[model samples]
Target chain A: MAHVISMLPVRNEAARWLRATLEQLSILTDRIVVFDDASADDTADFCKSYPKVRYYRGDIPWFEQNEAELRRHLWELATYENPEWILALDADELFEERATLELPWLLNQEDYDAVAFRIFDFWKGTEQVRIDGAWNPWNRFSPLLVRYDSTLSPDWMAQPIHCGRFPLSYRDRVTFYSHLRVQHFGWARGDEHLKKYLFYRERDLAVYGAVQSHTESVLSSSITLEPWIPMPSPGWFSEKEHR
Target chain B: MKKRIAILTSNHFEPSGARQVYGGAERYGVELTKLLLDMDCDVEWWQVGDNWNKEIIPGVPIRGVPETETPYQTMPHLNQVFFEQAVDADGAIYFVMYLAYPTVFPNSISISHGIYWDHPGMDKFLPSALDRQEWHRRLQLAIGGVRSVVSVDTATINWVRATWPILAQKFSYVPNFVDLNSFYPQNKESRSPHPRLRVVFPRRATTVRGINEAGKTALWLTESHTDLEFHFVGRAHDDNMERTLTTWASSHDRIFYYWLPPHLMAELYRFSDIVWIPTKSSEGTSLSCLEAMASGCAVITTAVGGLCDLIQDGYSGLLIEPTARALADATKRLASDPQLRERLGTHAREVAETFSLDRWHSRWSEVITRVF
Candidate 1:
């Protein structure tokens, strides 16, 4: 028997949405671990009511700091819980009926480390969702299930709004699974919340760029550029090495 | 017998509420004209910058008149040429708020967009350096001889009706409406992906119209409530405001800002838990506030201008007198109480359904049919 664990990274969320997420967690997953990146509201305390949920507290200095730390901690927690499969998620994302049942089966498949599920975005309200009824073109990917033994872990590139990486990092080592659906709740009228996320994103990019350049300059001066007196061009270096 | 209605505006699209677009009167002109067209009457649109006699709809004609050589001084004269051209028609619905042109015809109906009054600077919010005596004089001259008058709301009509009480008596409140079919609430999942308290503030960076206490309240809320995310939409008016906000946002990870398209803005209302727009002064009925309410967002706003008409305290949404403290307190109230947010959001959406496009078009059709 394979152990399954779900993880959600959340900041501040609407109450109804939070309640929905909790409901989904109770039914589908064995253990739900949520990393509260020092949320400003009762999100932390609220998650505490559920016994199956494990909440980790972390201080977020900036947007990037929060995302990076959350991913790292989620990996650590998932690894420690030692679930055979880790279903990574955000507070608003949920598994569709098909994916909820098929997720375990897909993860257990031989040589599969991570699985990407198709995310149906209910762009319109409850009425539209009912009318359009499952086949809308707007659905994308939701990466809630990942094998712990896989090489995939948290990295800097997996930071912003969409932290999932594609092209299935290991084409040869891992097998691809499809037809599974994960429902994404990102597009709801909560775009006002998105503005706040963008603000931090802009700042995060600026700081990340500045730090990257600063590090490159420091590294080049001490190691790469300083050692080469004349600092020969590419052609010269290639010629010398070949000769 | 179809009436040919002429609407004077700068653009066909009025995306946001308040004075951002064709100003209040110009938008009112557009709304009135659209209403007439919906009633199956022949309508024509006249914009300042558009080409003359462009076809907007088949029988419904639209025209644009470019400003004259000396833009500031010659616009009124150019508008006069257009006005003269329009005089031969059966009747004209003119949004002549500024001193663009004098509608000499007895049949012209002037809708008041704004007033220059004694100090034009007060209305324009210009620096003390520029002399606005001419602006004020020209505005007074424009209103001096109009036969029929219209205003967007009671406050604006009241301001004008003090001078022309007869016209004020003739004043009718024709509110703006959003097409619910085009702009409705998003599904529950997209609106609130996680259970984080979503606080949305959709105001431009203008000091007069924007959430003045956003920066302070955001910082305070971010520090106190980590689970709450604050979203500030619309563009900043200047470099100073942008820089100030950027600096303020540097302190917290939760504070997020985004520049979005109108469709995306509609989507935001779905996701946001609470939509906050606290304006100090100069507000007509806010399309943004109405849109948010329609899209199922619990709203907190100041009782300014037409917002009073839309936001009913303890029912649809919360209305507080404009202040940082009031804004913060209202936000805190919604943030702490999930039940209140859900209840208010549910009611707000129901109330928004009443102001649909069909209702707006019907009301406007009456004004147009009257011209016949």
Candidate 2:
């Protein structure tokens, strides 16, 4: 049996959708490593309530100011658990229900070092994902699940804004592009869209000297939306299937 | 100290005298400068011309950089030159979206009027598959380099998003607007009683504007309907096109060809019952269409570019394909039904309120405020 640990970098998300995220993550992993980035809300207490969650709060806010440093800290904390695999995710992201069934098979495999999944950006509500224009998130694969390797040192993109999740060296290793999807409800609410827009205007402009173009597109009214369709996990790791 | 802003464009003047190149893009540039001026920012306009400098308006100077054309397009050269010239400025604005290709300055924004390559004639511009591929590559670099983009229509935004989904966050849709006060409908009591139904084609005589189709449709409708009057109320690109239009108008009864200044166009729209904006390709949210809608004229426009954003198929105005036969059919239908015209005109005016100049100013000011 292999132990799988899920690491999450979260901020003031207690009042939003943090609990629902924790509830879903608890079902998939043996232990959940949560690094709260100086959240002002009851996120630390909420996360502490979970038996599987090992919660740690930063002394000062760092996610918006120094994302790479924060992610590096989260990575170090997750590695301390001696888990076979680490699943890096945001507080607003949730894996599909099929991921629970697929995770055991995925962990038992020795052919791949990492796994990538298509992400769906849910707009206005949880039932539908935005498919129009730049909202086509499913077209690109995000490497969220990676096998732990102690020999190779992880290098993060040292920018405060748009610093990617996972080590910069993750692409060098073989990665399986999994069919399982991640539902990102970060931009699901209308008010949250405005809040995010203003947040980027303040943080990105101050740090990067320019607000990212996608920040302006968050509030677009003329977007094409499609209902969320659940994809059945490929039974590659089942008893009947052989590599 | 006022924040200094430099704007790079292809053309604002006609490369010679102080005479401004009157077009939708030029109008947008002027309006954007005015807004920046109101925000107390020192603004300057740079364009490809024969090295001249003059003030287009009070407190705003327009300078011309020597024209340099490359095989790919003149855009990359213009962007590089503008970046060098505007280095001292606090920030920059790429007035034309394509001009930001290959590179752009930090703390800069770009403006996309609409999708200009949707026309069939784009083959002549790109010529080869390799040329188009290179063009697309440069365009992606241009868009990625800019901090933000202000798109006049959703058409260009959608195209960019579909082409490069990663760059979707860069665009903000801000459609063109009309001055409701200047372009209001005439009261029924004030309008002079006229027997003939007046139909106006108030657009520049250019191939992309669907002038040939409009001319054919106007001629057909005039010959068929005894009580219909067709008016061509815009300037031609050159003397040859003007001569062609004048000759066509001379041979037909109830047909008129004339040009009016921007201020006087309100009166022309007020008297007209139906407006035709049959643009074949390369369009944004047209100023002419918005003015017509604000003036309560039932607009019949082709579903090209941002025209779709302004006129819903049967709600505010009639939308059709850019063909002479389609234009003729829509015109004939409107000419026969006065009640339908009135209903569409009223709804158009109502829709025009949402795209008021005040709203446009507020939206644009918000975008510029973040950058500057």
- Top-scoring candidate (TM-score): 2
What fraction of the true interface contacts does model 2 reproduce? Answer: 0.00
Residue-level lDDT of model 2, residues B102-175, one tens digit each, is 66778889998888888787788889999999888878888888899999999998998898999989998899
lDDT of 1 at A35: 77
lDDT of each: 0.57, 0.80
TM-score of each: 0.50, 0.59
Error of 1 at A65 (Å): 51
lDDT of 1 by residue, B25-76 (tens): 3334445655666566566666654343443332355555665343222246
Give the chain B TM-score achieved by candidate 2. 0.95
* Model 1 stretches with alpha carbons more than 4 Å out: A1-243, B1-4, B10-75, B85-90, B99-101, B112-148, B183-192, B236-252
For A103-182, candidate 2 gives per-residue lDDT tens digits of 55555645457777768898888888887666676445678888888877788887877777777765434455554678
> Which candidate has the highest lDDT of all?
2
Isolated chain A TM-score, each model: 0.65, 0.90
Which residue pairs of candidate 2 clash?
Answer: A213-B169, A213-B170, A214-B169, A214-B170
DockQ for every model, please.
0.01, 0.00
DockQ score of the complex predicted as candidate 1? 0.01
Q: What C-alpha lDDT does candidate 2 achieve relative to the native structure? A: 0.80
